[model samples]
Target: MKKYIIAGLLAWLPLAITVWVLRWVINLLESVFDVLVQGAAAILPLSTHDVLHQLVEIPGVGVAILLSLLLLTGIFVTNFVGQWSLRQWDALVSRIPIVKSIYTSVKQVSDTLFSSSGQAFREAVLVPYPHAGSLTIAFVTGRPSGTVAEHLDGEYVSLYVPTTPNPTSGFFLMMRRADVIPLAMSVDEALKYIISMGVVAPTAEGLASAPQTTRPAGL
Candidate 1:
């Protein structure tokens, strides 16, 4: 009886989560769309507000409107005027002190993670972290910068060591470039291995072969 219950739950769990995520996204888009419509209508008249409120409330209309707006925004942002406007808006935000710090930090992360030219998380590496003789999987974020780089002298690789079951939070480490061992597996494959706590291997061959390491050498 217990086995049957567990099996049923296992079957339904993924589907349930997918549906919940989609519904949540749709609801959020709908809320944004509703606010935009109300704001636009406010300038016209009270009659315009009544009509738009009803229109925006139609079952899936807000979702459709929101998607259309995103498409238009994508198209517009590719043009010169839109680019100039974006720069202006960014400059305005940059002058806001506290908001600038938060916004810039988050924007930099988003750009790094999504930009085609981004070097972040482009490779999986093996490093002896926490202590010597311990091998851990980390994603290459890029090279070290500023004072940290100057102090390290030789080439160094910046890496993100993600935690198991929840990969969103992780530690950042800077290690000697020579000390890092590159992996054959892709970033996605490496992430799966990490998130599963090594129970899930990154492909049969990639995980099976032992990677070479480096030492502190004569200093």
Candidate 2:
């Protein structure tokens, strides 16, 4: 009986979690849609107010609209006029005092992480952490630059060592490029492995492809 129960739970748990997440996202989008509809109703004719309210009540409409908007925005941003307009908008935003600092920081980070040509978080590696004897999974963020590079002894690479079960919080370290072992797994697979606390192991192929490493010469 215990074995049967365990098997049933293993089958049901994933599906339950997936559905819960989808429901939460849908609810959030619908709430935003409702707010927008209400604002529109206030300014538009009373005859059209009922139609907007009715549209908001329809299920899945918000998700569809949001998806379409994203698609359109993506299409627009690829053209010449769109690129020019984006630059103009960015220039205006940069002139704002307090808001510019926050916006600029966030925009720089987003661009680095999302840009096709950027190298941040592109490779997963193994590096010694906490102590020389212990090793952990880390992502290669980039190489140290400017004044920071001058203080370092040898060729070094910046790494982000994420904690298990929560990849958002992690340690940042700079280690000799020779000391880190490159893994075959993609960034997404490595993230899943970290978030699962080693429960969801990488494929055998990925494991086989990782190069063996020795302790750094000084360590």
lDDT for residue 45 in candidate 1, whole number 0-100: 80
Q: Model 2 over residues 50-73: C-alpha lDDT tens digits? A: 788779878899888877888999
Show model 1 residue runs off by greater than 4 Å.
41-44, 205-219
* Global fold similarity of model 2 (TM-score): 0.89
lDDT of each structure?
Answer: 0.84, 0.88
Question: lDDT per residue, candidate 1, 1-219, as tens digits?
Answer: 999999999899989989999999999988888788868987888777778978886889999878898899988877999989988988999999899999999989998988889999998877777777587889999998887778887899889998887999989988888877777778888988888788777676665423343544331
Q: How many Å off is the CA of 162 in candidate 2?
A: 1.1
Which residue segments of model 2 deviate by more than 4 Å?
Answer: 38-47, 209-215
Worst 10 residues of 2 by lDDT: 209-218
| Top lDDT model | 2
Candidate 1 lDDT score at position 12:
100
CA lDDT of 161 in candidate 2? Answer: 95
